[model samples]
Target chain A: MALFATCLTDTFYPDTARAVVRLLERLGCTVDFPLGQTCCGQMHFNTGYREQAKPLAQRYAGVFAGYHAVVVPSGSCAGMVREFHPGLVGASPATTMTYELTEFLVDVLGVTDVGAYFPHRVTYHPTCHSLRMLGVGDRPLTLLRAVRGLDLVELPFAETCCGFGGTFAVKNAETSTAMLADKMRCVLDTGAEVVTAGDNSCLMHIGGGLSRVRAGVRPVHLAEILASTEEEPWAAIR
Target chain B: MGSNPVTWLGTPPFPKAAHAALGDSQLRANLRKATGTIRAKRAEAVAELSDWERLRRAGEAIKDDVLSRLDTYLERLERAVTERGGVVHWARDAAEANDTVLRLTREAGADEVVKVKSMATQEIGLNEALAAGGVHAIETDLAELIVQLGHDRPSHILVPAIHRNRAEIRDIFRRQMPSAPPWLSDKPVALTEAARRHLRRKFLSAKVAISGANFAVADTGSIVVVESEGNGRMCLTLPRTLITVMGLEKIVPTWRDLEVFLQLLPRSSTAERMNPYTSVWTGVTPGDGPQRFHLVLLDNGRTNALADPVGRQALRCIRCSACLNVCPVYERTGGQAYGSVYPGPIGAILAPQLVGDMHDAQAASLPYASSLCGACYEVCPVRINIPEVLVHLRAQATAAKGSRGPEALGMAAAGWVFADPKRYEAAQRAGSLARFLARDGWITRLPFPGSRWTASRDVPAPPAESFRMWWRRTRG
Candidate 1:
């Protein structure tokens, strides 16, 4: 299996990518990181540059063509590949092989318990793409519940977008911030030490707001929490 | 008078308009309260049916079949209505539709007409057109009446005064309605009673009435209007001459097909099993209802919209406003920011297409107003893939802007870099140089385009090494 660490995770949140590698290896699966992969063309495709996105989509298909399974840690990127690649580059073998981290863990591996440990009060926010696009329902929570020492509190209005809609945050910043403010309030209301989601893009927006306000709450990726164990504990990178 | 009233002239682009709307705390509060309440109720109402998904599929299929052969269904409808003692008028655009209605009102020799809250008439700016022709159009629906009385644009599809709370509404009534009681309170019943008493005289005295149909059954030549208030029934029955302006797309082939929409519309819109009033009329009825009836089938850029294979699905909208209620963007910015009568997720896709001018900056910006969260698509009764259509429209808007624009140049540059891993890694390493400006691992501010992001949210400084660099160093 190959790991498709999305462009956002590779640049600003490299540790989240590392966590995925660690978790997959620990689950007794050999994972390959394809060096030729850069992006899934989601940003370009979504922002009205379909012609520009074509090359990236082609690159994605070529780089991961023969892999038995391609595990993507981000739901939006996975959706871009599985749902949209057919329209852009036609149906490639890699498109069907690609799976979101939670989908791969639960459906492919058939394991809810990954033998992980995290001793913090954490709330789970279901990102819009993961919830609605990929339909990764309760799979992350199902895994979190089996973590030996973790408390998974439900986020109020967890289905709402965190408003980090790629260029949308830049183009329509005020409206984006208004949405982020509500998401931040919901995260704060949980009173949990950490807020976690499958997609780091949304986490970055939510965490950016929380960090700006000095809210003292950490926005951690689901991979980092699942990768943590008694022998190797996950520490805050920031 | 030559200028088209249908155009949202001088309205700023969506982002600029939304920026102003975001500052209005009162409007924000009203929108949040109303949409949130409806969102919950709609969810419960939809959940009651075990076969809701099946019904939604049927609705989509039925609408698709109608749109596939719209000309046939429309001709069949025209013939049926003509046989039943009604006049059918084909309007290629808003100007023609307005002219037809104005001529009809003039023929009736009535200066004033009562309306049943039709989006078609709103799209055509029919009232303004009539007023220009020395005729008056009185809105009879409570919300439409409030909007008309307040001299305000209709902000929502179902509830035009959704931006105004009860206190604001009371003020509008007190200041605008001459018939409103001096001691009227802000209570819900009081507001409705006031609007009812004010419109009753107009309903009794008006010789001509106008409406937009919810569904027009082709075989039966019947027009359906479903409403919570009974004003639609009064307008349909009381007037001597009735004129209905309908969009070309609001047609179903058979009466049986109407059952699927009847089940979907009310629950998805008002969160009720059935609306309080559903008035379905077939042409004219002598000595029973209106003596003369005119049906204006409006094209008004619908054919242009229907020409696009992907965007044509927007024509299937039942106007339930379920998408509007669940939309987070609409919940915050309110409807006026969209600069069209159709606002929220539906407007984001529909307005740009109906206008058919992506070069128009305001219409172009509509597609970008959404976050592409897919919330609207999930809630739509007719299953319009709003996010898909939004992105598709954005591509058209981008093409219309040409390649010389800043956004286009940036996108082209990024596309070049992303085409190869070597160029992408080089760009990432260069991006990490911004860390020199970082304080405590975050870039609090930046310039131009980046400033837009850092205006409200902090940006994380790029890591020292890209993931590929780390992977090679550790595993090599």
Candidate 2:
């Protein structure tokens, strides 16, 4: 299996990427990181810079060509790879090989419980791309439900976008903030100690707001929580 | 005469308009309540029909069929309407459409006309044009009347005064409406009663009526007006002369096609099983209704829209405003920010294409207003790929700009770095230097464009080593 550690995870959330690798390897898979991997070009494609996105997409396809299965930690990047890659790089094996982390675990690995444990009251935000684009319905939730000692609370309006739409967060800051405020309010209402999502982009947006107000609700990647165990706690890594 | 252009003249770009709208706490609250309530009901309404997906597909197919053979269907409609004693006039643009209506009103020798809520007329600036031509167009729809009374532009497509709550509407009625009883209250029933009483006078006395059709069937030459109130029926039946200005895109091929739209529109727009009144008319009747009838088939940049294969799909819109109710941007900013009669996701695509000039700053700024959340597409009964069209329009707008200078150069430079692993690694190393600026592992603010991001939220600190670096060290 190949792991496409997205640009943000590679640069800022390396621990999350490491968690995915740890989780995957523990499940009896040899994880290969295509060193040549870079950005998914979602920012470029979404911002109407398709010409710039094209080459990056082609590079991505080239790097992960022979892998039978490619796993991605982030939902948006996985959606970009699965949904938009065909438009950028044309129909290819690479397009069909990509799977979001939860989808791979539930569908491919066929495992409800990966023998993980996370003792926290956490709410899961299903990012828009993961929910709508990938249609990764209940896979992440199913995985979370199985974690021993995990108290997974359902997020209110869980399917709505967190408004971290790539460049949209920066370009349309006020509206984005307004939406984030609503999402944060919902998270707070759940009274959960942590907020978790498949995509770090949304987590970053939600985390930023929570941290700013000192809300005491930490944002954790789903992979990190799923990678958690009685011996190696998820909290220790953060 | 007020010409057939949108009422919004000198409309600012989206960012400026949105900035003003965002500051309006009242407007935001109204939009949130209205949109949320409607959307919740719509979901329930849709879930009640198990074959909704089938209905949506059928609606989409019918519209696509109409668009593909629009010329054939339109000619068929003209013949049918003419046979039924209706005068079918063609307007190449808004100016022509306004001229047609003005001439018809003048022919009827009426200074004032009662109007049914029509987005087409609003799009063409008909009331403003009519007012300019020494004609008073009395808007009979409850929401339209509120907007007209307040001297404000119509905001939402279905509910023009959606930005105004009950209290504000009561104030508008108390201030602007002469017929408002002293005992009128801020409750919805009281507000609607005041409007009904006020419009009743205009309905009975007006010699001419002007409207926009919801669906104009090609086979029957029948024009349909689906409304919550019976205002549309009064405008159609009570007047001596009637004029309907309809977008060419509103045509569906056959009378049977009404089944799909009648089901889809009410459910999607108002979350109703069926609207309170749905009036359908073909041309003129001697003694039964209006003695004279005029149907203005309007182009007004629709031909320009139909010229592009991708953009033409937006014409499939049933004008349900389902997309608007589900859109986060519309909920936050309200409809006025869109600067056109059409607002929300549909407006974002339609306004730019209808304007057909990306250099026009107001139209161009619209395509970027959304977060590309895809909610609009999900709820769209006709399944118009609004997000797809938004990105497509963005590309067109970007191309029309010719050169973005620094932004273009920046993208190119970033593209270059991303193409090669070594260059990408080097760039990552350079970016990681920002760790020094982190306070407790989060960077709060930065320069220029990054400042835009940090203005509302903090960014995480770049890790000491990239993931690939960590991988190489451990694996080796």
The A-chain TM-scores of all the candidates are: 0.98, 0.98
Q: Number of backbone collisions per candidate, in order?
A: 0, 6
Ten-residue segment with the worst summed lDDT in candidate 2 chain A? Answer: A162-171
Best by lDDT: 1
Per-candidate TM-score against the hidden true structure: 0.99, 0.98
Name model 1 segments beyond 4 Å from true: A236-238, B1-7
Q: Evaluated with TM-score, which candidate comes out highest?
A: 1
Task: Residues B121-190, candidate 2: write the lDDT tens digits.
Answer: 9898888888899999999988999899999988899999999988889999999989997777999888
User: After superposition, which runs of candidate 2 have C-alpha atoms over 4 Å from their true positions?
Assistant: A236-238, B1-4
Question: Mind giving the per-residue lDDT tens digits that candidate 1 earns over B171-240?
Answer: 9999999998879999999998888889899999999999999999999899999998889899999999
Q: For candidate 1, list the clashing residue pairs, or say none.
A: none
Model 2: per-residue Cα lDDT at residue B355: 78
lDDT score for residue B96 of model 2: 93
State residue B472's C-alpha deviation in candidate 1, in Å. Answer: 0.6
Chain B TM-score for all candidates, comma-separated: 0.99, 0.97
